[model samples]
Target: MPEIRNFCIIAHIDHGKSTLADRLLERTGAITEREMQEQILDDMDLERERGITIKSHAIKMDYERPNGEKVIFNLIDTPGHVDFAYEVSRALKACEGALLVVDAAQGVEAQTISTLYQAIDQDLEIVPVINKIDLPGADIEGVSQQIVDLIGCDHKDILQVSGKTGDGVDLLLEAVYELIPGPGREKDKPLKALIFDSIFNTYRGSIVYVRVMEGTLHKGEGIRFMATDKEYDAEEIGYLKLEKMKTDKLEAGEVGYVIGSVKSLQDARVGDTLTTTKNPAKEPIPGYQEVKPMVFSGIYPTDSDDFEDLRSALEKLQLNDASLSYQPETSKALGFGFRAGFLGLLHMEIVQERLDREFDIDIITTVPNVEYEVHKMEKSEVVKKIVDNPSEMPDPGKVEQVYEPYIKASIITPSEYIGPIMNLCQERRGNYINQLHMQSNRVEITYELPMAEVVFDFYDRLKSSTRGYASLDYEFLEYRKGDLVRLDILLNGDPVDALSSITHRDKAYDLGRKLCGKLKELIPQQQFEVAIQAAIGSRVIARDTIRAMRKDVTAKCYGGDISRKRKLLEKQKEGKKRMKNVGSVEVPQEAFLAVLSMDDD
Candidate 1:
């Protein structure tokens, strides 16, 4: 264990974390110069195209010191986005130290502060490294000072490096071995390993990535999940060098994958403890919390026959992303679908895009929402129930109070756009908390806001208001009592279940009116006139009509008698009245999605 080191890399999005990983890999000879690629740690095409890491990965590398001593380094690369906080936490738990990379040009953004707190909470040894020194206007001294002010680190200990040019990376690796202590060696103890992450395969059911905490784990051994108590036979064990490399045994303080005869992904849950069946550990490790979904929406297939295919795709997606949660749902207007939950807006968008591009399925999504706590009067007493769907919300008279989720949002931007940014946040019902004057004439403002408001295009609007000069990060706060109302959209007096939403009562009328007008434009004109109305309970606040198609009966008459034209017009009017009584309005898929495209605050 003295020669082995476990560490992870954490940074803000697009702050040279992946580039640094590639440079370190090249410097250590993990991959030769011919095999190197930009952002090699990001394996997904979506991640590569966007230049961000969405998942955490573990790799084993062999590095030699100047004294010709060999050291084994287990490096885990983590996601920098706020949506993947759970992923970041899992990676942090497996490491003894972290490399906190900061961009020299853009010093101490919102996510950098957020990730710093997480690493501090884990009590891991943090080594600050200022990256991207080759860029124009790179301020190494300014960033180093910011690190000292924010994290209370000594300015002299901060290292400066350029990830693009592979400068000072060798010195950074040597500092890692000298500064961070290796894991303690253990023996004569029961086998205990922590499953930090896992993925599914068709031939081999579940491949669980683990970090051994106590004893040895070998191939062809019987193991049991400490949480679920389910048993499995380990089929293979190996290292994760961006690929599965087979090995016979994995000892304490080593990170590797364990292929077992497990049927489903749920059987091998992330954060669960794994132990050998014959000699199990005395107790499971602490800090195994389940991930709760922050955003919820309905996903319906465009073709009703493809509902089964959508379900299969969701199940497969859940196998890889354990944070995703879903259940079957039926909508009156959308037919059969599922109500899916995600970590945040980005997580939700990525899942939707993958379903379309990877699975070849076309789907329509409702406006995103967060869970609400509804308190209703039951038997002369108040009863509370958590409601995620607006259609499931209770009537206003039956409830005593309604609580909506809120988040503490942090924004870092140049001082020039502070006025417009504050105005935008206030328009969305944000409550100002405090502000701090940062270096480089920048400001960091904190606000308390409704999660619903931010879930639908809040980030986009913020960027537009600030001209893309601002960065934002947020964390979930507690639920607070809110004046909430469920707004329902009705087509020809029939309520559409999929178009219902929960909003603040003060802004409900304006939002309802806007939705009614948008739906009027999206729904095609029909033979019979269709009335679109937005209602709150029994009160209709807004209404619009799609005019019926008009026919030129007189044109077809040519030089015929006037009486013939009158007779044709009367017959047509009678036919329209009959059709209006029996026909139903067909709302297009775009009509349901149009609610999400609205930019009005």
Candidate 2:
């Protein structure tokens, strides 16, 4: 316990957190030069494809000091995105300290500050390291001052290292041991361990990653999960190295894994406490909260027959990703589907991509939406309803008011682009909050923006406006009263339920016009002219016309028979009237997906 040290790495996305982990593994001789891989801790194929860490990984490394003393290092790599903040919280609880990695050229970004505050709140010792110093644009002096000014850490103590070149990495390992203390000792106490993370394997069942706080856990011991109170025999106990290395037992103040023959992933939950069945701990560990999904969208298979297969694929995927939540829903236009909730936009995209690539399933995802509160008045009583889908909104006459979710968004960038960012936020219905100057040149702007405004292409536009120098982070604030109305799209004369959306009253006309124009371009022309209109309640805000495909019936006629051509045209017009009464527009799948790309103008 005296020589064992546990710590995690936290950083903003693309700040080289994964690269630093690889360098640390190399320095400790955990993997030889031959076994080295880029982003070694990011295990998912999707993660590698997207070049981001979506999940947390823990590995044990053995390091030796200059005094010929051996020390055990338990390294946990956490996700840098705000969507996985819950996972970061769990990882921080299992470790004594964290390494806050910052890019030398970029200084501190949005996620950097957000994660740093989380670590500070957790009371974890933070070691600030400036990475990517080998780049020509790397500004070591500027970044060091930023750390001192923003985080209030000593500037002289900050470690300057290049994760790419492996420069100054050996000193970082030494600093970890000197700065981070070992786990507290309680060998005589009853069995107590905190489950920080878990995974499901087809052959071995559930492999739970745990940090032993007290007592010992041995192989073949019956243990109970504090959250579920379900007992399972620990089939194997071991340390989490590059692979699971079997051990006879794990003692107090060590981080490792337990392979219990748990049948389901829910049984081995993260943030749950584990204790021996014979002598259970008096209470469960603190700070265990169930994750609630922040965004909701409908997912439907391209082929309705694959609904069952989609359900099965979702079941298997959820076994590993417990944060994903879904329930069966049917759309009139899309047929059978499921309304799934996710943590953020990236999370929603990742899940959709995995379902497509891994499961070999073609899916059509509707436009993402947030949960809204609808207040309806019936006589003298008021009924509050939570609506996740816009099509499910009550009639305009019955609804008294509507409230939409808002977020406290933080944007960190160079001071030059502050004006454009402010204009963009205001256009998206963002209310001004406050701004602060960090380290002189960098600025942090706060705004209260509706969640609906930030969901689609907001980040992309911000990057474009700032020349990719700005980063945004947001948290859900309470719902507020909104003067919003439901915008419905009508094809010919009938409304399309899937194309309905909730928008602010002021922007309703412009958004409706855009959506109607987009649909007109996407929907193929039918035998009869199609009238595409965007409506709000009983009024039409925008309209577009798709001309019917014309056929020159008198083109083959000859011999200067002008009167004969006119008679043929008359017959053709009469036939077209009959076809127009019975024809229906055949909208392609692209029409449904086009709504996803609609942005705030």
Candidate 3:
């Protein structure tokens, strides 16, 4: 029997995880020259289209050694975003070791630091790979040291490889064989498997991913998912060995897939234990942590008529991803949409793009939001506050609370922009930390800032302010008390809670003016004049308006090709359908997306 190995590649965003996977695929001759596409592991259309690794892909490669030894490699690629940390964790559980990829120029980043700790927590051996060595800003030596410092390994221990040029790629494969330990499952024991991942297929029903610990499985066998206590006959037992092709069976100390006519999602929990009736394992795999989506927002159809379609789309997505949560709620402002929770903003974007592109639905998102704790004198309450403008906050009474989540932010940039960057961070209530010099001209600065500060348009501001030379990464820390108040935007006298927002006093004016400016553009010239008021409580801080359209109808509308005139009126009605009316004034979807565009103006 061939010695089997399973490993996963992990990294921070843009650290070249997918590229490394591509080089490995190429090195093993698994992909032909024509099939030699970039970032082949990024299989999802959105993942490839956006050039972001939102989903993970895996493949098996057959390796031959000069010493006449043969081995099978199961390489799994995983998402780097903290939002998908749970998915990463599940992948990690199936592996005995990991290829921890880091951008040579960027050193360690937010999710890198976060996921590294998770790998360590899982007791998996680490094999650090410094990628992007072919790039202009490569800091191979300095980043090597950072790896040594953070991971407590020597500089010689870090492997420097460029997935782009395939430099040192052969050595990366060598390390996989030399450094990573082989699977630890003992054959005599009963069957114990951890279902790391799963997906639903139209023809196959549901397919589950599992790492076998003991015993073996075969076709027509019976098995049980521990969580659901549901048993299903193994219609097929397979290995993703060469392709997603099937095998007669997969032995213990291997990773493979199980497919049957399954339906319930509960049968395929990420951390669930799987066992067979022939023999039962005494204990399940040790490490398990349920992943929860932290950020939420309303998902609605741009056309209110497609509300049912939106519901079905969300349901279809939820069927595959059990972590996605939803609560049916009515938006007093936007009619009805599901309040959906996601792992993070990127997760929110992936869902939105899939809805807009895959399902061909026009979704109106009410802003990516977070859950908040409303503290009162008597008791504390948790609430999902979708405050876009602060004017709707009730008068302070029976309460004493001001808290917002903060994050530790790490920014890598050219040293030339450090001064302005530092000033901007200070203005946003960022607490300073030390900086490290990388290469000859690059620096990595660390800071702790409220998540709210960066949650808005700070990304754009940072890019524009730094002349696009900076990269930033952050993860949630703890909530802290600050001088915070709700900022509200009013369309006429009625407060639109969708426009109500909580912000630090220092940033309220800028955010308010910026938000109001967006509303001004989104609000077309109404039949009647409409005031766009941004305020704190009743105090209006910024004001703009959509002056009523005067003489909207030209004599041309009545006379031209009368049929063409009718077509123009129909077009006007369709345009009006795209606009969301808040009370009497019409606001377009661009208005919500443009909420942060005022900074450019």
Please give the RMSD of candidate 3 to the true structure.
7.3
Give the least accurate 10-residue stretch of model 2, judged by summed lDDT.
Answer: 592-601
Q: Per-residue CA lDDT of candidate 2, range 424-516, in tens?
A: 999999999999998849999999999988887788999999999999999888999999889998888888888888889999998888888
Estimate the lDDT of model 2: 0.90
Q: Give per-model TM-scores.
A: 0.95, 0.95, 0.82
Ranking by TM-score: 2, 1, 3
What is the Å distance of residue 142 in model 1 from its true position?
A: 2.3
Q: After aligning candidate 1 to the native by TM-score, how far in Å is the CA of 581 from where it should be? A: 1.2
Between candidates 1 and 3, the lDDT winner: 1
Against the unseen true structure, what C-alpha lDDT does each candidate score? 0.90, 0.90, 0.75
Once all C-alphas are superposed, what RMSD does model 2 give against the true structure?
A: 2.0
Clashing pairs in 1: none
Task: Please say which candidate is ahead in TM-score: 2 or 3.
Answer: 2
